[model samples]
Target chain A: MRHALILLGVLMAGMGLSVEAGLLGPLGEQVGHLSATLSIFMVGALLLSLALVFAPKRQLGALFKQPRWLLTGGILGPVYVIVLTLATPLVGVGMTMVGILCGQVAASVAIDHFGWLGSEQRKVDGYRIGALAMILAALWLM
Target chain B: MLLPLIFILLLVGGAVLAAQSSINGRLGAKAGVIESSWLTFVIGAVLTFLLMFFFEPAQQATLFSVPKWQLTGALFGVVYMLAIVFAVPRVGTAAATVAVISGQLLMSLLIDHFGWLSNAVRPLDASRYIAMALLIGAIGLIYLSHQQRHRRLASQPS
Candidate 1:
């Protein structure tokens, strides 16, 4: 039950991030180019640094040591944003958002159940599977 | 512009990232979620800068021209990263994602429908509400089933 709550929280956070990104997309478009996007990331890094300075030393060190994982995650961040930015220009916000939602729900199910890419293996059951199907269908219809 | 196509692609990209984040969360949880999140942001920022330097040198100078409003997005990002770390431990990835999405959709509706951002007001119509409802429903179904499976597994334990 606790785990389920955690998963829900992650999903909500992810969703919030997407909406925020969408809001920023217009600004990004106005600014134009990768540099503009990168600047936002730089600010994010700066904020993270500030956070680290206030945190315990041991915690900070532990965070720094996971470089490889961080790198992997880091790569995804830009790629995801760049792709999203490109897509927004190609399609309207509504349709683009729908597509992303569909893809997320589908991929999340697989990641959650099978423990893909070193994730903790959680059981895939009927309801979750059905939900994925429904989301996909919703995306298609939208 | 091509609004529909962009929307579709954004949705797909968003989904991929969502899955990736879930995996990342689980992997990073063992190491400490905050620490992992911080590292991911640092690495992601560095990589983004490198990509910009190589591919979009022409726009580098414009970096300083960034508007103050955009910084709001960065602030939101910080809140998001922290929320992901904190929520993952209590709710699990799927549920956490749902909660975030629910928050976003509600917020987005307000922003778009009310023209809260000073942009053109895109009224919240029935279809948009319907879409949000379906998405929420889908999330609920998945979380409920996940809990059931977990319970069953606990009962069968070694």
Candidate 2:
């Protein structure tokens, strides 16, 4: 039951990304991709911080107390955005999206299979391999 | 040289993106989801500001000048951040990523077909239709495997 909801939520997240892709394109055309990306983060951070003010106070200090490696996740946010900014012009959007899916499939499967990054261990069984193959074929077809 | 470099970079970008969310999911388990997402945006805002200052060229128009609808796109990033942080640990990273990717594929196709956001009109082709079907099949297979695996785990004595 809970799993179904999470699946739905993530799907919505994906939809949001698609909207972002469409919207960002125009902004990138107006301003360079880097500037557009900065604009995005600036607005998001401002809005989220504003929202946070009224919400329950977080144990934000606890975040700093955690291992340093964990901090890298936040840093990766800009890395991914900057990468997209740089790569989009070299390769078209379609190819870039395919490359992203390929990398995501490989990493997600491997990370979970090995229980990397403290994720739960799930074996890479035949079904997953089949799914991966199908995803690859889909990308190829695309 | 440039083609291969960009290809490798895009691949790295994808890995970084998926891995970041998974790691953040763990962080979300420790910190609250909103706080975890907030951390990314805060860090991201500062980092991108520096990059933009040094690297980005002057813009024709600022954010405020763009069509208001375009600005709304930024809000969706927040939704994605919160959702991924909430979903990754619960659904497992693979399932969450696949689900999100599937959604992207579908929505992107629609956006292309309709030329939404003033993008050039690019109608979907036969290959795209087939790709969509294959993605759905892949999702179905992954979901079943995930469910079966969890059921077995749940039945076992902890």
Which runs of model 1 end up more than 4 angstroms from their true locations? Answer: A1-19, A63-71, A133-142, B1-16, B57-63, B88-93
Q: Give the alpha carbon lDDT tens digit for every residue of A6-108 in model 2.
A: 7777877898898997888777889778777877788888887877777777677887877888777878988888777778777888788877777887888
Steric clashes per prediction: 50, 0
Candidate 2 is graded, for docking, as medium
Worst 10 contiguous positions by lDDT, candidate 1 chain B: B55-64
Model 1 lDDT at residue B149: 67
Tens digit of lDDT per residue, candidate 2, span B33-134? 877888888888889889888988787787778777777778888899889988888877888888888878778777878888777888989998988898
Q: How close is candidate 1 to the true structure, as a TM-score?
A: 0.79
Q: Point to the candidate with the largest DockQ.
A: 2
Please give each candidate's TM-score.
0.79, 0.93
User: DockQ of all candidates, in order?
Assistant: 0.50, 0.73
